[model samples]
Target: MVDTMKAAVFQGEGRLEFEERPIPQIERADHVIVEVGAVGICGTDLHALKVPPGTLSRIPTGVIMGHEIAGRVAEVGEDVLSVKPGDHVLVDQNAPCGMCEMCRRGRPNYCISIRNVPGFPGAPNTYGLFQDGGLAKYVRVRELNVIRIDRSVPIWQAAVAEPIGVGLHGLRKVNVRVGETAVVLGAGPIGLVVTALLKRSGVGQLIVVEPLELRRQAALACGATAVINPKEADTVERVLAETNGTGADIVAEAVGWTLDTCIQVASNGARIILYGESELDDVIPIAPTLIGIKELEIYGVFLAPFVFESARSILESGTLPLDQIVSHRLPLEKVHEGLDALRDGRALKVVIHPNEF
Candidate 1:
């Protein structure tokens, strides 16, 4: 059966329009259709519509655009047993080759075969970026992306799991411990979630560095022991002061292009987790001599792998109170304004509902 549903399609030059497209159906035994109820506007979507970096530089000008989604299962193919109709669900953004070394090492986010991720359509039909993303009335997740959430859980709060998974990966990369102090740079959704997770994981103390006032407040709400507004004082001094001049035990740098901040504030033996993807042109003056002398470890993390099971549990338990981060809710028809709001930094996690709102 064919199903055409209202969807937000990327038009061009920072614009999105509501269009009617055929709802994806199960052609493969493991495929499942999800009726999207809540989709978050991630930074990538806004960046694609505005700046268009990387493979997104030459966006084809027409496609579905979004990566954060939470919804209910519409139909499941015969081979699908993990989720059922009426099941509340969240989508894992990364797909991996289970046999790769990275996957074998429990890091599916770094799948060596990521160049040609399947199920999702994108550039070259082989390169998936702006060609087709998750912002739609319905999406055909390869069952690989589907993780069931408890029916009692609010779908909107569960939607926060994707970014939390990002934090999960970062913290795991940094090898964070119960008593370790952590400094999270950037107070956006990802940073806020990272701080929240760090607190939940029992970090001794956490300092959040953000330039925006509202974001600083959000960090406080997320359990940040200290909020650093870089403009008011030296960010490094603030973080160092909080650490008793010893510096943080771990620094999760979620703000790309701010590598200098990590270098100036980290204590000896501190592990730095680089999670942000900033502009390529942006450069930081890293003092290699100091880094080498400090015996600091640097780790890079991309997305989550095989983490959906644990991520769902955290989401279901309502640990982070994520629904409070949502700044605006608009219908699929008004996605442009939502994207614009995200680009302008006016909203924290603007979401688009399929129909009901």
Candidate 2:
């Protein structure tokens, strides 16, 4: 039986209209329909809204647009055994084609057939970017994309697993050693996660650089050894002085295009991770000579790669205060206002309840 449900659809630039759409049903044997309880407004979502029309490649207009999701299974297909109806689950946003070379190499996140596949709404990309996502009452996903979570976990906290998963992958990429000094640029949700993970891993010094006061406080609460407001103080000088002029052992850029700042405060042979979402046309000029002279090893991480489970485990351990990251709990009807809050830096993480009015 088909049913209609309210959804937040993305139009062109800066337009997110709430309208009724069909409630998704189990279409394939391995598919599951999720009754979305909490879906976070991601940095990617905010970036798309701020960019010009057509700049976000292959993302069609009017697609339901939220990927960070946590909810209960409303329906499961005949062959879906991983999760049953009424089970709480965290949705993995990556949708990789299993037949491609990258998939064969176990790098499905870099699935070669992602955009080339036909008949799928987000054929080439992951969910929500080029297809309908979880910012609605219901969303259909493959069984492989859903991970069962403990029923005791709050849905909003489960939703945060996605962003923290990104941080996990990024931190893993750099392999920050224990007792090593680290610097994190930006104090957004992702930055806070990275900071928390670094601290939990026993990093000797965790410095968070942020311009906003609220996020800086959030960073400290998340386990930052020190918070630097770049707007008020010289972040580079502060980091250099704090480390006795050596600089940080690891530097991560959670805010876009902060590579230059990372370079300034990076110690020789420091590893850098760039995981921040940036616009398609955004570019940053960097000194290649400095990178070579300092022997810096730079790494870039995309979507979460086999890190969701770890993120959930971390959340369950009660190390990271996931709820503190959310600044707004908005209904599906006011999704536009939530996005506005993100754009204006008034909110860190805004979660939408599609089932709520």
By TM-score, the best candidate is 2
Q: Each model's number of backbone clashes?
A: 0, 2
Cα TM-score of candidate 1: 0.90
lDDT of each: 0.76, 0.84
Residue 23 shift from truth in candidate 1, angstroms? 2.1
lDDT digits (tens) for residues 1-357 of candidate 1: 556877777677766777888887789998878888777777766566664444323455767776677889989999998999988888875556578676798756556645333343322321124345567778776687788888777766766777888788778766678988889999888888888898898998899999898888888898888898899989887787788899988888887777777877889999998988766555667888878888888887666665677888887788885855777888877777877777677878787787452
Q: Extract clashing residue pairs from model 2.
A: 114-124, 115-124
Worst 10 residues of 1 by lDDT: 119-128
Give TM per candidate.
Answer: 0.90, 0.93
Winning candidate number (lDDT):
2
When summed lDDT is taken over every stretch of 10 residues in candidate 2, the lowest stretch is 113-122
Candidate 1 has an lDDT of: 0.76
